[model samples]
Target: MLIPGTHYRLAFTQSVLALLQVINAPTHYRLDYPDLSLILALVRGGSLARASALLKVDVSTVFRAVRRLEAALGQQLFEKSGAGYLPTTLAQTLAEQAERAEQALEAARIGAEQGGEVISGTVRLTCTDSVLQSLLLPALARFMPSYPALTIELCTSNDFANLSRRDADIALRLTRTPPEHLVGRRLADISYRVCASAAYVQSVDSHDLAALTWIAPDDFLPDHPTVAWRRQQLPGVTPSYRCNSMLSVTELVRAGLGVAALPDFLIGDGLQPLTEPLHGYDTALWLLTRPDCRALRSVVTLFDELGLALKLP
Candidate 1:
């Protein structure tokens, strides 16, 4: 019969040796994975210079990364062609796998970053000049102080910012239909009305819209609802002052330069509404974000706050 202490010692020694053997075993796949992004960029960009530009790295860095990947895989991933570096079948396969991996990694990273209890980090917001000036700015005054850790970057543009490319984290838009790719909440219906400076409204016959001096958006924004309404309502009328930005038009109108069709949200203290809230020109105001970005705590908080603010008189 074996002593209990001796038996225990024998078992412990065998367990440790077994663990060491498992630990020493060579992994089927290398833990030091190749730089997938560099490889993908090279394949996508087609040339060293192009890849360097795309990755924002030096050409030598791209060359070195490629060389390292080739050395690890023990194969030539690309061949020199007159057009560009032609990726081999193996390279193509690897690139495709790498893209999927990159997407997965990005999703994971976003999840980890946004999953925190505290609402923080920068939230990029995009909207039109009028909306930014009239509505969002005032709302942000109250909202910003509450979330001191959160920062907001506002981008004002007439054209829709690309959320997929990360042009903006959030978009406030007046549209009948928001982009299908984005996830959002429709806050409220925005109404357009003929507006003028208090002095202009008092001076002119408000009913004779065609007879009044008009301030219009520039040729670039011909599709603007106000432009369309003006085109329809005053067929032969030409604007006295044409401006590119709606904010500029508002300023001009407020200065009593010309009457303008303005959104209800933008008619501040100086401007007077000449017409009843028009029905056909109404569009819904939407707060939109990338599906992935909606998970972020800061984004969620801002979105909720904005919705609440808009509801207020």
Candidate 2:
């Protein structure tokens, strides 16, 4: 009874509406969650070798994990470039989510441990070579025995470690200005003194800093306050030896190569101080940690112990 043309148009309209509805409906895709730890390592380490080292896995394993993640998501998470595997936007988002989840898990673990009698966990601590050798190791030798179950992973480097990235649970830094995001206590001012090998001190006019052959930290430490102070005090005094590391500079001075500015803590039996302890050129030492990490029992215990040890004579 219906007109053929009108009926055809109505059916077509209805079909198009149904198609639109289907298109508008959210598509559900099942994805197998990739290993969150592997992803976090990749994100933080930024290279295959680095990720493998951080995760303590073989490089091929990381590659396979990345491939699996890509396949599961049906999208590339990272792109291979000349520098290394650069994470895509999606990868960054995924990494952020993983970090949040990790934080939540850590919080839960810490809470559960707090309810228990034993305080046990690993705490990663980072500091400069000088601090590690002169101060921290000795302190830990005594402090660690008190907590039988606690484990300490010590990392020594001259470069500033980013605590926010979980590079370390605790960091000891000598800085005039600490980063705003980090929460910590400024322990004390690290004093420095002009020092030379006993032989070198005997040979030169000990009173006249200018008459002595100098050993200075190289351009690697351009912003070092004591180095800058030395430059100002001895104008046009070219160093006989320039070393990249402060420890190397100290060693060179100890070898009677030249006189150099050294931290008070590093003035060993072989070296003699040319000047009394100098203060203004020194930087304040900070015991720093990320805000989220402050709650961890391991971090708190180490932080308190380090603060007390550093304050000691």
Candidate 3:
């Protein structure tokens, strides 16, 4: 029997073909699958850089595609704007049709499972710098050697990558709830604690939290867990150091600059916890990937390996 969405996917495929035929007849200019796919990605992403990331191509390639498609169809598909590339009416319509076609094609590909050794191609994984250094890298070191020909790209950032837009194939995030659109499971409970360098902890009177120097998340990170926790728990106290990145804050703590709230997994080396996990500052570590990407062998392998390795014993 066919997969559950086979009929719906086939219907969309037929509709896209009908739309393409009509578009081609009047202009007598043939646009191939690549051209349409680029258009759809460009429209969805709204910029050359974003489109490039989604398509796994260079920015110049996306720019060149735009120029070529405009020349071929003799229509202005997009207009340059301060924000990014703004799609014109024609581009928007074409993109909608292309998107449906792309979805149908991907569904068919996933259905086939394309039985073969998945020995090549890069899989992009996104996560925070802290996660990269503390957890993911070690797990990857063990898992990557197994797939000799496969390459994995790491995109480290504080912001979540847009998997729906294909910014990355998979993501390892610390969150209470993963996005509904992505498929994944919580690996473990991530706990946080007030931490300081072991030397600093020993030098200072640990019981006197108010007397200790403090480091905190900067103004840019107003929503950071440490920000509110500091304000509420240590009222009227000011931080000596403020960093926008959690990794940077961790480094500052390691240097014995000041005490700061940090994830338990990240508190190692010479760091020591001043308190047990801070209440209301805990979240789970989640391994998430788009539903479409979950079908790919490379993604499946990495996902499974990470799930098995990262889960707390």
Listed per model in order, the count of residue pairs whose N, CA or C atoms clash below 3 Å is 0, 0, 0
Model 1, residue 263: displacement in angstroms?
0.7
Question: Which candidate, 1 or 2, would have the higher lDDT against the true structure?
Answer: 1
Worst 10-residue lDDT window for candidate 1 reads 22-31
lDDT string for model 2 (203-310, tens) is: 878898887889988888888876888878788788989988788889999999888888877889899888987667888788888889888987898889888988
Instruction: Single out the weakest 10-residue window by summed lDDT for candidate 2.
Output: 23-32
lDDT of 1 by residue, 137-211 (tens): 888887677665566788887766557678998888888888898988888888889899888888878888899
lDDT of candidate 1 vs native?
Answer: 0.77
Q: Tell me, by lDDT, which candidate is best.
A: 3
Global lDDT of each candidate: 0.77, 0.75, 0.80
Q: Which parts of model 1 are misplaced by more than 4 Å?
A: 1-117
Clashing pairs in 1: none
lDDT for predicted candidate 3 compared with the true structure: 0.80
Candidate 2 ranges with C-alpha deviation above 4 Å: 1-116
Each candidate structure's TM-score, on Cα atoms with residue i matched to residue i, is 0.61, 0.62, 0.62
lDDT of 3 at 144: 76
Model 3 C-alpha lDDT per residue in residues 1-313, reported as the tens digit of each score: 8797665545465655665654543466766666777888889899999999999999998999899878878778899999899998888888878765665455445445755444455678999888899899888887777665566788886655557679898898888877788899899998788999988887889877878898888886787767778788889789999987788999999998889999878888898888978888788888899989867887888888889888874
